[model samples]
Target: MKQLQKLKILDLQDNRIQGLIPNDLCHLQNLGSLALSENELFGQILTCLRNFTFLREIFLDSNKLTSIIPTNLFNLEDILYLNLSSNYLSDYLPPHIGRLKAVIQIDLSVNNFSSNIPSEVGGLQTLADLSLAHNRLQGPVPESFGNLISLQSLDLSYNNLSGVIPKCQKRERTPPQTELLPTLAHGRIAYQELLRATDGFSDSNLLGTRSFGSVYRGTFTDGTILAIKRLDIMTDLACALDYLHHGYSTPLVHCDLKPSNVLLDEDMVAHLCDFGIAKFLGEGESIAHPNTLATLGYIAPESPQERINMREALAALKKIRHQFTQAVKGEKHEDCIALRGESVGSSSEP
Candidate 1:
C-alpha cells in the first residue's frame, strides 16, 4: 500500500471499519471525496486528512469522534460540502472557517460545540446552507452575519443562542453600539392571487400544518395557484406582534412563519399570510420586551432586528422555491401537485 498513489475517491461509509483512519491514507494527493460516516471512528479527523490537498467533499458524521475541529482543515479551498454532525465533538469551532471560501453546505448539528459561533463564519461567501442546531452553543449571535450575502438557509435551533436577529437595513441606534444591524428585507407572497383562485383558503385547499399554523392551497381570480398560510393566532401572538412592529419601516413581521404559514394556490404560487402578530414598526413600541422579539422558530437565527416583513419574507421564500426547484427537477411550479397535505411539523418558537 506504500506505493499506491493518485487515488481520487475512497468511500468506506456505513461500514464496520474501526480504528483510526489509516494515517497513510493521506498519501493520495488526488483524494477528493471521502465518506466515513456512520462508523465507530474516533479521534481528530482533520490531521488524518491533512495531506489530501484536493479534498472537496468529506463526510465524517455519525461517528465517535471527539475534540475540536482542526484549524488546518479549512485550508482546503475547494471543499464544497462537509458534515461533522451527530458526534461527541466539543469545544468552540475553528474561528477562521471562512478560509474555506468554496464550502457551500456544512452541518455541525447535534454536537457538544459550545459558546458563540465565530463572527468570521459570516465571511464564508459561497455558503448557502448552514446548520449548527441541537448543540450547547450559547451567547448572542454575531451581528456580522449580515455579511453572508449568499447564505440562503440557516438553522441554529435547540441551542442557547440569544439576542435579536440582525436586520438588512440599519435603523438609527441609541447607545452602546451606535451601529444598527442590517434590516431584514420583507418576504413577498407572490401567490396571494393564487389564494384567491383557491377560494380563499378553504378546507379543500389545505396543504400542510406545523406547530404554528396551517397552510392551504388556493388560486387567484386570474387562475394563478398559491399557498395560503393560516397561522395559529391563539398561540403565537407575542411573536407575530413583535415582528410586525419592530422589523419594518411600518413593522410587518409574520411572528410565525412555518410550514403551515405557507400555502399553494391553483397556479402553484407560494404565499405567506396570517398577520395575527403583524405589527407596525415605530420607536419605543413594545411587542413584549425591548430586548427580544417573536417566537423561537420560523425567525431566522442570525437576525438581530425585530422586523421580518415583506422584503425579507420574499427573500426567504425565493430561497425555499429555489430549493424546491432543484428537488423536483424543474417542475415549473405545477408538476408536483400531490393531493395529500402533510401535517404541520412542530416549531422551535415559544
Candidate 2:
C-alpha cells in the first residue's frame, strides 16, 4: 500500500473485510477520500490518518473500531464529511473538533463517548448535519450550539443530558436556488389547504393513532402524498413534567399522569389538564405518596407499595419510549423489560 502514494480514493465500504486497518494504507498521504464503512473492521482509527491532509471524506461507520478518537484527525480542516457512528469509540470528544472548519456533516452517535459535548463544536459554521445520540454523554448541552448558523439537522437524544436546550437562531442566508427541492417550491400552506388536502381529515385518510395524536395521509392536487401528524403531545408532556420536577422551588409531582389528563389546544400543543392528585415535595424529599392513586396499569409496578418520585417516573417513561422506538425499528427490546422487572422485584424484598 505504501507504493500507492498516488492513490487518491480508497473505498471498500460494505465489503466483508475484517481485521485492523493496515498501517501501510496510511502511507497514502495524498488520498482524497477513504470509505471503509459497514465492515467487520476492529481496532482504533489510525493516528497517521491525520497525515492525509488532502482527504475530503472519511466513512468508517458500522464497524467494531474502539478507542478514543485521534486528536489529530480533527485537524483536517478541509474534510467535508466525517462519519464514525456505530463504533465502540470511547472517551471525551477532543476540544479540537472545532478545527474542522469546512466540514459539512458529522456523525459520532452510537458510541461510548462521555462527559460534556465540546462547546467548540459550535464553531463549525458550515456544518449542516450533526448527530450525537445514543451515547453516554452527560452534562448540560452547550449554549454555544446556538451559534451553528448553517445547521439544518441535529440529533442529541438518548443521552444523559439535562437543562434547557438553547434555541438556535434562524439562518439569515438563503440557500442557492440549485439546492432547493421541487416540493419546497410551493412554500407553506394554510390550515384550510391542509383540510382540503386531507379531505376534511376523513376516516379514510387516517393513518394511525397513538397516546399523543392521530396521523393522516394527505394528498395534493398534484398527487404528492404526505403524512401529517396532528399534535406534538409527547414533547409537551415531557417539558411539563420536567418543569414540575426541576424548575419549581418546591418540586411538584403529578401523581396521576395518564393520557386522559393530557389535553391539546387549537394550536395542537399539549397541556396537563388535571392536577387534582398533585403532590409538592419539600427540600431533600424525593418520594411522596398521595391519598389518591393513579390509574391502574398507568403507574409503575412498585408505585403502590413504594411511591416513586417524579424523576423516577420520568425515567420510566423515557425507558418505555426507548423500548418502543427500538421495537419499531425491528430490534429486540425484551431485555429492557426483563431488567426492569428484576430491579423492581429486588427492591421489594424485605
Candidate 3:
C-alpha cells in the first residue's frame, strides 16, 4: 500500500478482502476515495483513519465491523461520503458528528447505534443524504437539525426516535443541477425503451391517469415491470420532485400529491410521481397561480393547522399498517368460522 502513494481511488468492493482495514493504506497522503464494501472486513475502525487528511470518500458498508465508533475517525476533515451501513457497529455517535464539515452523505443504517443523535449533527451543513435507519437510537429528532438547511434525503426510520420534528432551518436554495431520475443511476431505461415497452404510449397499457398525465404499465425486454407516469411538465424540461419533496437538501412541498400522482411499483412501493407544482420549503411564494395548491385529498393541509415531521410520518404510516393488519385478521377469522360451520352442517346431513 505504501508503494501506491499516488493512488487516489482504491476500490475493493465485492471482493473477499477480510480482516481489519489496512492501517498502512493511510500512507497514501493523496488518497481521495476508498471503497471496501461487500467484504468480510472486521474489527474496530481505527484512529489511524484521521491521518488520511485528504481522504474525501469511504465505503465500509456490509462488513462485520463492531464496537463504538472511534471519535478520532470523525476528525477526518476532508471526508465527504461515509457509508458504514449493514455492519454490526455499536455505540452512540460522538458529538463531533456535526463536525463533518465537508461530508455530504452519511449512512449508519442497520447498525446497533443506541442513544440520542447528537444535536451537533446539524452542523453537517454540507450533508445531503443522512441515513440512520434500523438503529437502536431513541429520543427526539434534534431541534438543531433545523440548521441542516442543505439536507435532502433523510432516513431515520425503524428507530425509537420520538417528539415533533424541528422545522428545518432554511438555507440558501440551490436547485439540484441534476433531476431526480438521474439520481437512479442504476436500472435506468431510456425514453425509447419506455416507448417500446408501453407500445407507443397506447391506452391499453394505461394503468391510470393523474393531474399531470397518464401512467402506463411498462415491461422491458428483461421482463422487469415498471409503472411510468407521463407528466406534462417534462418530456422537455426535467426535475426530481419526488426526491426533492421527500428529502431534497431541504423539505419540499409537493403541491399536487394525489392518488393519480402516486405510482406503485411491482413491489407495491408507492413513489411520488408528479411534480408539476412542487416547492422547496425555503423557497418563498408561488411563481405560478398563487393559490395553486395540492390535491384536496392527498395534499397535507397548510402547515400549523396540519404538520408532521419524519417521526410523525413514520408513526402515521405504522398506524395505518396496523389497521390494515387488523382488518385482514378479522376477515380471516370470519372465513375460518364460516368454513367450520359448513363442515359441521355437511357432517350432520341425513
Whole-model lDDT per candidate: 0.62, 0.74, 0.66
TM-score against truth, every candidate: 0.47, 0.50, 0.49
RMSD of each: 21.0, 18.8, 22.6
Model 2 stretches astray by more than 4 angstroms: 174-350
If both were scored by lDDT, which would come out higher, candidate 1 or candidate 3? 3
Tens digit of per-residue lDDT, candidate 1, span 34-82: 7899998987775756666667778999998988888788877667789
Q: Stretches of candidate 3 above 4 Å error?
A: 172-350
Best by lDDT: 2
Q: Which ten residues in a row have the lowest lDDT in candidate 1?
A: 335-344
Q: What is the C-alpha lDDT profile of model 3 across 1-350, one tens digit per residue?
A: 88899776688999998899878876876666778999999998867778776577789899999987889888875577899999999988899887787687999999999999999998887788999999999999998889887788889999999997777776755544433233234546678888888999885565444334456767677655566887544211112232233222344555654558765434343445444465445444334333333432333323333456755543333333333334344744232223123321111100
Clash totals, every prediction: 63, 0, 8
What TM-score would candidate 1 get against the native? 0.47
